[model samples]
Target: MASYSIGDVADKCGINPVTLRAWQRRYGLLKPLRSEGGHRQFDEADIQRIEEIQRWIKSGISVSKVKAILDTNQGAVDKGWITQQEELITILRCVRPDDLRFKIVEYSQQFDAATLIDHVYIPVRQRLGFEQNTVRNICGLLDGALIEYVANQLILSRKRKGKPALLISWDDPDRTRLWLEAWRLSTQGWHIDLLAEPVELPRPEFFPGHHIFVWAGKLITSRQKEQLEYWHEQGYSIFHHNPDLTS
Candidate 1:
């Protein structure tokens, strides 16, 4: 009957403590015991349940639907991405900036960055791409709110100690995606110094012993590939992130 604190469970499950609280308060996915001080206390069974929840989420199911799936012990019946996309589209169509930003923050608390990016953000953007000019204006609003949200997340992440890394994009037209990727890295225990604009590759000696993450929204040219290889040879830990290739 050993019990663990919320931080302990978050570390063990590779989940944020904020996300764990969201699961309990918003989604009812967990019901941990409260100590005399009103602190959350999780038992071993709770840990196992968290792993199960992670499995469902990794399969592209939204946290909002996880409770029902677990209760029924059934496979995902409806598409989570579609549901999330529809909700977001409705919010955007309302043309209310505050509501959109509020939902973005709420989503960040509920779901991990990767899940939010892949399931909700990317799919919504793609769906709106085929729409008319007025709808496309709404898409631009979403982008602005997302950029602001991720930037604020990055600032908060800096208060924690993590390995120092530089995040930059070379030839990515969308700065919002770059910021989103930077925030994603921050969640992975990286203290990110993000350069949102495309810049020439600096000398490895400038950031000695630092991880350099390069993001390209499109296919990299031959010269860009050579530059990356050269940086690798120069003892810089180079990681190329191409959303086009991965997504």
Candidate 2:
């Protein structure tokens, strides 16, 4: 019988409040009760329904098609991420910077960062990796577009009111993945400050009271582990990202 605000639901479901509002206003996906103040109030059922929608999205079902599937209570139809990935690949191969940026922004609006990264961006990168000779050139183009998109998103996220957090990458070769990870966190309502460069373990005191998210694509060395443990003991919240977690 408990009621929750939109922000609470967004935090619990790992969705942006803007996306939740869009779901109601545009897609008619959610119908929450209105309080005396005319504010949206959600119950436990709404949270469960949001999770169901997330599962469908993670399974590669487009948002526009989700309502029909949910109403029918049918299992997910395998639309897959091929179409989206193909469109992005074409834009990248053509070296169309404007189209590429537009496509990336379009996808970000439709899908959350995690869904877009896992289903579209990462797959496109992998597909390009198999190219005969122009893999580097094409992937570089894609990375540039994505970096620009994420940078803008980061700036926008900073303008919003949210918990302050610092994201750092340690010895991770794939810089694009780090940015994508930060973008994913930012979409979840965190004001992210990302250290894009690979650096040694930083002193927690430098950013007191800020949650620290560490990304190490490789295995954690003992020294690094000790430093993280030290930070934990000093009352710092640390989120360590490794291959197992990211993969």
Superpose all Cα atoms of candidate 2 onto the true structure and report the RMSD in Å to 1 decimal: 15.9
Flag clash pairs in model 2: none
lDDT of candidate 2 over 1-247, digit per residue (tens):
9999999999998999999999999999999999999999999999978887886676446788779757644331145566888898888778898999888888878877777886688757756764667754689899888988899989999888888888888766678888988888887778988887877666567777778888774356678788888878878888686432543
List residue ranges in candidate 2 displaced over 4 A. Answer: 1-77, 218-226, 242-247
Worst 10 residues of 1 by lDDT: 72-81
Give the winner by lDDT: 2
Tens-digit lDDT track of model 1 for 142-185: 99999888888888898998888898777666777788788778
Per-candidate clashes come to 0, 0
**What does the lDDT read for residue 42 in candidate 1?**
99
Cα deviation at 194, candidate 2, in Å, is 1.1
Q: Please give the distance, in angstroms, between residue 156's alpha carbon in candidate 2 and its true position after superposition.
A: 1.4
Cα lDDT of model 2 overall? 0.79
TM-score of each: 0.62, 0.62
